[model samples]
Target: MVDSAIITDNSEVLLHFDLKLEDGSAADSTRVHNKPAKLVMGDGSLTPNFESCLRGLKAGDKKTFTLPPDDAFGMPNPDNIHHMERSKFNLDAPAEVGMIIGFTQPGGMEIPGIIRAVAGDSVTVDFNHPLAGETVVFSVEILKVK
Candidate 1:
């Protein structure tokens, strides 16, 4: 058998990944668009639970598995949902339900918040990740492991 470099805690990896919901709807894919992504194994870019699954995998390896909410993006936090004043939004911009808006934080970082409802002066915006609370299937191909 040919020996290969295995993924380790500090390994730098390049990989292609496809993310899908439990119902088979596609969420994201590096193979479908853009070049393979690079990451250091211990970087917080991926959840620890998710990175654990990649341990020991080598280049040219392909893997697919389902991850529960806690293992994936984790359950949505209610605190992530906030009620905003309608006046804070641009009147020209369509503040319709389901639309994602960029909100600037006090720290000057911008985050996306999806509008859930518009009632009177209140606009319900959910800042949780879109995939939060979902069980997802991940398909990954390890292109390079250093």
Candidate 2:
């Protein structure tokens, strides 16, 4: 039998993975959508800690690992939550809690913000990633490691 190639710093990887929360709710999953993710090792595509987990694994290897909040999406930052004026939103659009709106920054980059609350003229918008501060279970099946 031929030995399979191991994942290394230069590997171009194609894999299926899932990110689930402690409550057993899936945050993201490639298998659910019938798609696989591709990435080159040592790239910023995966966090340093996350990339390390894939290192040394070979094709066809399946593994599950848990990441702390910091290692995953990271702890939520209070600064990411902003209080905006109600007039800032377009009048045609409904401004309600739990609504995700795309906000254009000074650099013209569109960033998504979730409405946390609407009180009179003040609308609290959280710019933090939806998975921020969430510890996640990451499971992966390495389909190819070239």
Candidate 3:
């Protein structure tokens, strides 16, 4: 019996990963929360470039790859920034800069948007990903592949 499997286009991969920003600051890490990430290859959740980097990796494999903004989260799009009336925000908890709030889409899906500015009756919300426009370092330790 084979003791291990390599990550393929349809493999289910379980791994611990560290995402670091261009400034060398830790952006996210599965090890920090002690929870490994699980994903099926070819799933739309990961960019094709990211999937390609993991191809053929097996359990116990360790790899680190740098992805530019386009390959990672893509650059921030101006269209993703929106300005809304201040009344739309909850009065109980006033919206402030750097606050992330969930906004429901037309399809009932919720997406997180960060408050960028609040001026009078106008509030600016950025829907771009937090790491958008930034290059990132992805360090992964493959735990299991099936």
Candidate 4:
């Protein structure tokens, strides 16, 4: 058994989850594959609101919650879309729809951008998360809390 309060800042947890879109379409589900994901709390990886929902949950507890766009991946920003010359990419790389390219940031972090479209000389890349701006429904089963 696991204490719910222990699931706080910097705590590590293992859980299986199913994520669904607003349309009731299944986006991701651990139940189907039976693999649990590990997550560290308060790492900025999960929004505060989303973390709040997990508060007081113990192991073996199953909970389903809905999160708005802001509480999830966040709203997509138009500025995250960048149009670059096709020549900027390596010819061998092959720019295709859904290809992810890593761009080096000022702090040396590699940011991934998905290729949205390719025109004559311009290639459109979007840095926004693929699930951004979409409300999410999560069904979570707490497997372990540490």
Among these predicted structures, which one has the highest TM-score?
A: 3
Q: What would you estimate as the lDDT of candidate 3? A: 0.92
Q: Kindly list the per-residue Cα lDDT of model 4 for residues 70-117, writing each as its tens digit.
A: 898999999999999999889678788899989899999999999999
**Candidate 1 or 3, higher TM-score?**
3
Quote the positional error of residue 53 for candidate 4 in Å: 1.5
By summed lDDT, the worst window of 10 consecutive residues in model 1 runs over 87-96
In candidate 4, residue 133 scores what lDDT?
A: 96
TM-scores of the candidates in the order shown: 0.93, 0.91, 0.95, 0.84
Task: Give me the runs in candidate 4 sitting further than 4 Å from their true place.
Answer: 1-6, 31-33
For model 3, residues 45-138, the per-residue Cα lDDT tens digits are 6789888989989999999999999999999999999999999998775789999999999999999999999999999999999999999999
Clashes of each: 0, 0, 0, 0
For model 2, residues 53-93, the per-residue Cα lDDT tens digits are: 89999888999999998988899899999999998888777
Q: Give the lDDT ranking, best first.
A: 3, 1, 2, 4
Error of 4 at 146 (Å): 2.7
Instruction: Give lDDT: candidate 3, residue 27.
Output: 95
Question: How much lDDT does each candidate structure score?
Answer: 0.92, 0.91, 0.92, 0.86
Mind giving the per-residue lDDT tens digits that candidate 1 earns over 15-121? 99999999999999887767898999988888898799899899999999899999999999999999988888886775789999898899999999999999998
